[model samples]
Target: MIATNEKLLLDALPQPVISIGSNRHVTYANFAAQEFFGSSLNVLRRQHIVDVLPFGSPVISLVERCLDNSLSFNEYGIDLTPPTQIGGTNNGRMVDLHVTPTEHEEGNRQALIVVQPRSIANHIDRQLTHRGAARSVSAMSAMLAHEIKNPLSGIKGAAQLLEGDAGPDGVELTRLICSETERITGLVDQFEQFTETHADINSPVNVHAVLE
Candidate 1:
């Protein structure tokens, strides 16, 4: 029988979670784990962790470490190749794994394993595209501003001179120049804001609070 707390923990985790006994056999797997491994809980419980996952996977190391040291082991960027279902092409998917000893009593121990994927290449591609877009927007904004500034100044000067010479009729043209310049300035300010660099502070925060 599974403990209530243990069941709640397994169900709450966002990523797939699996528990392995001292014998390296899967004792339990969360719903996410079932979906990811393409197997039901009953089928997975009957298999060994090593059999379901690739041999010598980083997850194996994590499991070994937790058992040996009786401590939690958290690893990042682990490449895990989940077992492919029959008749399915091997997608060669990789995942990150984390293992921690959940129970240890009278020399009988069990570990909780969490799985997450890290597609670094894909993330890099996305960042590069974002940078390219920012750069393009900056260049276009600068070019447009430069091209318009000189003509705008000339128009403002001419409007002012016309206002001085003509009667109230030319005052409207001067007002137009002022309004147009204000609009252009607002656009340039927006462009500058977009070009500014953003700083991300990396520190441990309460993940539960963030979720709430």
Candidate 2:
């Protein structure tokens, strides 16, 4: 009864977690794990790691390494698609895999595999990339704001002046030109603001923190 309760507790965790035996068969899969792989506990337990995971998955290699070394291992941002399709879509999550060895019996080792998905990790990567790209365009934004904006504004003013004397079609074209120039100028102004705030933030963190 206590063991069943313990298993239930582990299953309550949000991240997918599984245990792999030395023989490459899966020993246990938590609820989240079952959901991630789109399988039930009975099916998962009967399957080998390779059978569950897609072909050429790095996780297969990582699990093998952990068993061979009898050590804990972790890998980040891995694509772990399962072989079975769920609703015609891949039943896999991009995850960080952590494997720690356990000795259920003397000289017989098993490992706990923790699967943490990388959706949040990918978001951070994109945020950092956005900031870097924003920084890269700082000089260009400054140049455009000065060299281009003033001239463009002058052109817009000229168009507005001509609009009064223009035919109906000519007036519409001039208005479009003015609107486009204003839109471009607004974009350049936004790029300039991004440069001023480089978004450099510092705090205590861990790889798992990014997951949160």
Count of clashes, each model = 2, 0
**Which residue segments of model 1 deviate by more than 4 Å?**
85-90, 104-107, 119-212
What RMSD value applies to candidate 1? 17.3
Task: Tell me the tens digit of each residue's lDDT in model 1 across 1-212.
Answer: 35778778887877998888888888888888888788898998898878888767777777877876788877765645665543355344556677888764465788888888666796567569888998888777667766776677777677777777766756877778777876776676565454433234489999999999
Q: Which regions of candidate 2 deviate over 4 angstroms?
A: 1-5, 86-88, 120-212
Q: In lDDT terms, which candidate is top?
A: 2
- Per-prediction TM-score: 0.51, 0.53
